[model samples]
Target: MGTRGQSSAMGREARDPRLDAVIQTLQEIGNLMGRQAQERAANIAQATEAATTAAVNGNQANQGQAQLKPPKFDGKGDPEAAPRWVEELEKAFEVLGCTEAEKVTLAVYLLQDNANDWWKATRGRVFPEGTAQTWAVFSENFYGKFFSESAKERKLAEFMRLHQGQMTVDQYEAEFARLSKFAPRMIDHPEDKA
Candidate 1:
């Protein structure tokens, strides 16, 4: 119920009438600044909300477009007759000098055929009539057809020492190609195995 001398929330002594005029102007400036602050806060909230909504909308639209669009394809031409891995396998085959490589090459071109017969044909060594030594027979049937005489003797001696005069069917066929680099070519065959 206080009137002219009432204190405000700051609890200072009530302003006098002459000073009240200055207080009233200061109060008006404070109200104006408060209103300006409220207006600026409202504008910032609206702008932030609008930016968030726009970003969400943009993300949703991008996701929808991505789902609807087909993948970009070269479709340059029909694929080659075989997959590219086949070519790599063929290249690896060239470096391999053994029966497995030869058999694998045959199988690939034969349209998924097996080399059962090729294995069977070269399976056992045939000891020729004239020679007591079975090594010559092993060489002719398994390795390149003709080996130089010295190369033949060196190989036969190694084979006898390793196998102790007994050889398995497929044993020498595997190692002979790798070992025979020093062994001269017994026969000259064309590169064209076709």
Candidate 2:
């Protein structure tokens, strides 16, 4: 009975170091897993925060755009109406901090009746698939369609023939300002404009 007890005690002593090593390994593995879990959770949190920020920014932009009320164009009325509509739309775009794409999109959205029909017909020709839709391009197409060369030439001639003779100072200044838009190069310098 004594020998059996001593052997059992020796056996337990021999297994103690192995048990301790297994326990240490298990603790190390658990710590590594915990760290990995923490890292994954942090990544998820950051991604969620980024997504929320993007959504908020998008909503703010939408709100800003919603506040804007650009005038509609029907491609009728005075020939000068085209330039006036463009000017108003440009001002609105400036206030809204619109990108070039946004400018074209919003301008197109404001088009009604004949103007909308014209854009629909011209869109395919002006902007092919995979081509960049730019404000400059749209402007060129719009001016080409609405503003005739004859009308531009006539305005230029009128600007060249303008004079302050027999007119009030205010009237002359107003007339000069109105016609000068047709010949920008003629009054490009401030001294020349004066």
lDDT top scorer: 2
Q: Which lDDT tens digits does candidate 1 get at residues 63-145?
A: 53323211221212222212222343344334332244233333324332222343345444343345343323433442332
Candidate 1 residue 73 C-alpha distance from true site, Å: 37
**Candidate 1 has what TM-score?**
0.23
lDDT of 2 by residue, 16-126 (tens): 788899999999999998997777557645544554565567776455444345579998877778877888888777765566787899899999999899999989999
TM-score of each: 0.23, 0.59
Best prediction by TM-score: 2
Candidate 1 regions off by >4 Å?
1-16, 59-194
Error of 1 at 23 (Å): 0.8
Q: Distance from true position, residue 75, model 1, in Å?
A: 43
